[model samples]
Target: MRFRIAAALLTTAAIGLAGCSTGAQASDPNGPLRVAVSPQPHGEILEFVDEELAERAGLDLEIETFSDYNRPNEALTQGELEANYYQHQPFLDEYRTEKGGEFAWVQPVHLEPLAVYSKEHRSLQDLPQGAKVTLSNDPANRLRGLKLLADNGVLRLKPEVSESARVEEAVAENPKNLELSTLSPDQLPRTVEEADAAIVNGNYALKANLKNPVAIESAEGSPYVNGLVTTPQLKDDPRVVKLAELLRSPEVAEFIRQNYTKETVVPAA
Candidate 1:
């Protein structure tokens, strides 16, 4: 396994401290641990830890924020970052397979339900035939979004298509003949403005302040909860472990509920 789960957090924290004890960077008292995160909630959550919790835990935290979801895992795999906090396991699994890099994830901290927001359409049924609908360009999210549409009776996948099916396999049935277009997670908001509606990652939806999406991923047992992803080498680094702990702390949970509305983001179970 690229990242082995720790038997207990105490044991992991001890391992992390051991790696961080030496002046690895030689300048700071606590060696700097570089982590990549998404802008809205992940970055906000990290900022809080970087500001409020890390110093007390004796961890020097540095943040790299990404608008696009592509760079974090690539950075981690290439040794540019120690860990990242913006992606779910399904995405990590698909990315590792597609991009040919090894990656692993820790326990999830939060679920950012993918949602569909519209500028012109009042409801999915109301959207005219051939209405352009933007979906995630990434296969995992695209399939999930298409599945949401499928569950709602808007479209269906071919019988042979698996749960993680991509766009090519998704036209099993389109009664309304709605035109589905693909867009990267970052661009979904702008695409939604131009198109009839777009299934959007929750962070981007919140960043764009898009209201009343025609569809949203069900929060119950959603596979899209974001978590810490790290290279196998740094999986036990104390600073990384500390950051993961802080991410799941009560304070962070309260902060998330307070800052981002409960209706959108929820702490992972």
Candidate 2:
């Protein structure tokens, strides 16, 4: 009877030890960190860092790519992704306010300047009166394009309008009577021939071979700084903190400089 009791106690201790071991492994610091990214430069840039730096930092980065601008945030908020790297602060702020998503910015990663491109006109000055202009239809980018227009002195906005200003909110003064048309961001390049000019995001511009943008957002003092963001729950996670640091590293900066060229996508260091 005593032998059986001793054996049972030994078995229980072994099981307890095994449970502790499993718990420790589950909480390992070097576990994989899942990150969702938008297609093109954002995902491509993350791949570069994942291959070159993440491993060295004892991090295994799992990248999930999405085609739409809205899915990355949705996936992150749903806890399906650890973090995302596809939006600027303004867009993120708007999303959180409008959708009630609980997320926060980890840090600014890169800046993709919104550029006003034209196939017909070389400069804004050449654009004739009542010329049709194509802007992004998305709520976030519409505001960005409006700000870009305001910056170029093409139109004057109300004094109350800020960087978060949208087309509906704009109070045009001496507007040159330009006819503004909003379209999907992807279609901006395609509409260039039909419209006098189009505001194109940098990624789409790069894909469509429209590199030398006639006018680009001034990166020096621009408010549109792209960033890495995660749910508020994971904000304190060490892996998230490490990834944020890796984003601003020398390696990432060098990669951006070599890959993007000509200050189109500047590192937000």
Candidate 3:
């Protein structure tokens, strides 16, 4: 896991060294809206808009599919993409704070609920001591995933920890001493099949066809619904507005609500 993280960091650094637009040649006022997206719901939803509604609305949509959780933000920051739809506001807040980038938020399109999946263990209680578990490593998601452990009595967290908490902030009262590993959200689904358990992002879960999670984040109060994001300068671009409007339309919402399992993917209101 350590080796994988190191390699991922190196990949990120390579992107920085190679990419240089800096959100300058940002977006076309009337051209295709180049947007980055995760491979599942984000990509699937955008493809729907692009094929079914874009021409009618006079919006030419170009979609860039990103399988890596970190790259979309980097691409958006580097102007390799005009906007992205693969992250929540918490992630955007953490990214802005970490990179000092001015990524702006549009409305949330859908919710990919975080879930705990395991091929080895049927439930959290079944997980034995020192069992290796993989989770999303990014600050916001690390906190959110860890809170599932805390919430389900598998572990305990420090008092006053809010939605933005990180793994290092976690003071676990884990009697089992479950060995925890943090990976990118995109990596968790695959790792869970090998490790004792994993807290996977719903998008990856469905993409990989991993099923029957032992635990899930509820839609009632979950905050990780993915939204459209853009550079501050392009926030009000007509293309962006049209894309956002189409994404949240009844048509798209019905597609999400029908095409995906309600437990794994929920259309955000």
Candidate 4:
């Protein structure tokens, strides 16, 4: 309850937003460990920790909730935040590769499965031919959606296509001839009313309160485990290490299990 929540909004038209300070100096070992996170599960989980566990553990946590996918890592890299906790390995890897930052992946906390959801349709097979299928515009996530469709037999990806292949190049066949459209990840859940089907990230779906996805990606062998990230310099800091440890503890895992369905959020093994 003593922790503060800063809301950062990112419009799809303008991704570059002015940075807001967390008032947490990374150089101060005893100061609050500031972390940037997505609003739904990430922010909620951190809130639970800050309220129920952090004080007892001798940790001070300041949680900032970002609606945008790109800004948390940017804030962390710019020294505006001590750490961040919203992205999975693939997304983080892409950001580090493209931005040339040394953010360390501290620990895997949970997996938010990517799922296919629709308002008018009951299943992926129920989707009509030439139906509009919406997906995330971000490259890594776009590929993830494409793969999810391929895995479900709604489409087929080119065997020769690499992870970095263009979305168009990745698709070898569209049996339903579905028209694919890309939008910001936050916009995906809203597409339920407009698009015939949409591949949505779990947190967004949970935010939108969309229950019963037609198809959800399996947690088994999934590489998209959401975790904590910090600068290499602070990777081994006791506070960072402790936070990571608490995130993966049995108590936190039990909280995730109690609060969300396994298909929506699975604690990382």
How high is the CA lDDT of each candidate model? 0.75, 0.75, 0.79, 0.85
Candidate 3: residue 164 Cα off by (Å): 7.6
Can you write out model 2's per-residue Cα lDDT over 128-159, one digit (the tens) per residue? 88989889887778877877887788887677
TM-score of 1: 0.83
Candidate 1 global Cα RMSD: 8.7
Model with the higher TM-score, candidate 2 or 4: 4
Clashes of 4: 0
TM-score of each: 0.83, 0.85, 0.86, 0.91
Q: Mind giving the per-residue lDDT tens digits that candidate 3 earns over 39-136? A: 67887888888778777888777776655667778777776667989889888887777778778898888888888988878899999989988888
Worst 10 residues of 3 by lDDT: 1-10
Model 1 regions more than 4 Å off: 1-30, 160-165
In model 4, what are the clashing residue pairs, if there are any? none
Superior by TM-score: candidate 2 or candidate 3:
3
Alpha-carbon deviation at 252 in model 4, angstroms: 0.9
Residue range 1-269, candidate 4, lDDT tens digits: 35675574323211443335543344678678888888879988888888888889988888877776777887777676789999998898888887877789899999999999888988898888999999998888899899899888889998866557777889999989999999998899999899999999999888889888899988889899999999999999998998998898898999999999876888998
lDDT of 1 at 135: 87
Error of 1 at 80 (Å): 2.4
Q: Best candidate per lDDT, number?
A: 4
